[model samples]
Target chain A: GENVGLHLPTLSVQEGDNSIINCAYSNSASDYFIWYKQESGKGPQFIIDIRSNMDKRQGQRVTVLLNKTVKHLSLQIAATQPGDSAVYFCAEISDSSYKLIFGSGTRLLVRP
Target chain B: GAGVSQSPSNKVTEKGKDVELRCDPISGHTALYWYRQRLGQGLEFLIYFQGNSAPDKSGLPSDRFSAERTGESVSTLTIQRTQQEDSAVYLCASSRRPSGNSPLHFGNGTRLTVT
Candidate 1:
């Protein structure tokens, strides 16, 4: 069975600092990867995504780096703010399927 | 212009009862998905519907879970004889297409608590 999972369950960071969340996936055929931010009592929101062809993709204040060779993915947030506190998940899409396999998720806690 | 919407934002039911969760995806979207998230956990892929073709229900935890979609529009997920472990947030999402390039638009989700 294919699975996408994270390295950590929780990450605590100070405001204005940088935050990095790591994820590892088991499926080598996965071609698309996405990072989502889920706030308490809300749905998962798309943050950024990277394709297997590309190693990196950047958004406003977020960056997603994919290492297909290692089957690893990471999300980096710059100048973390209190509002950035939420659970972050990494999802992978297989080349043959439309389903997105989500990681266990890492909770980001920003302290002011 | 609206995003994905789910009905019965919160549901509470006794054990052995059946529950239906509805999802209304954004107009014109061709792909819909259903996921479950238990407390302090990640999104569990339950089912996916792409266009009018047969759906991929591989992620469904058990036979108690089933879903249906009318054309490429609204979808309903039904849980029969729900158990306490069935308590979780049921999320629905829709994408412009079934391709990897398109990101999914999600609804707030339906919280189901089985007591």
Candidate 2:
């Protein structure tokens, strides 16, 4: 079955440091990728997204890099903050369907 | 102006009982989605509705899980003969379109606990 998985289940980073979370997807037909942040007792919040046509996309203090050859995706957060600590999930959208398949999620713990 | 909203922020039911979760998408949004999140897990795609067209229920786990949407507005997910494994946070999200660029806005989700 097609699936998306993260390299780490949890990552701890110090405040003011850059943090990177990695994901690998199996489906070659997937064309769209997104990153979501979910806080305790809250729903997942969309952060940034990238299309197959582009290898990278940047948002406020956040960047998403997509590597098609290796089927890898990464989210980089600059100057990690305590409020940024949450469960981060990477989702992939197949070209044949609009359904979004989410990864296991990586918990980011920012040490202040 | 409001994001997606869901009913019964928390639900406590017993095994073999049936439960209904409701989702109200943002105004004028044509796409609605339902996802399940188990404890310490990621989101599980369940079902999706796009306008008046036939719903894409392919992601539904089993026949025990069912969902319906009226037009492009509200949707209801009904779990029949729920089991302990059904305990999880049921989330509803809505997007402007079914494309990849359109980001989904999610509701707080209904936390269900089957005893």
- lDDT, candidate 1, at A64: 91
Task: Write down the TM-score for model 1.
Answer: 0.93
Q: What DockQ do you compute for every candidate structure?
A: 0.41, 0.41
Could you give the CAPRI-style class of model 1? acceptable
Q: Could you give candidate 2's per-residue lDDT for residues A1-112 as a string of tens digits?
A: 1111234388999999999999998788898999999887888899999999999999999999999999999999999999998889889996678798888889899999
For residues B1-115, write the lDDT of model 1, one tens digit per residue.
8889999999999999999999999999999999998777788888888875546788999999989999989899999999999998899999988758888889989999999
lDDT of 1 by residue, A4-68 (tens): 12334789999999999999997999988889998878898999988899998889999999888
Deviation from native of the Cα of residue A86 in model 2, angstroms: 0.3
Q: Residue pairs in steric clash, candidate 2?
A: none
Give me the runs in candidate 1 sitting further than 4 Å from their true place: A1-8
Docking class of 2: acceptable
Candidate 2 chain B, poorest ten consecutive residues by summed lDDT: B50-59
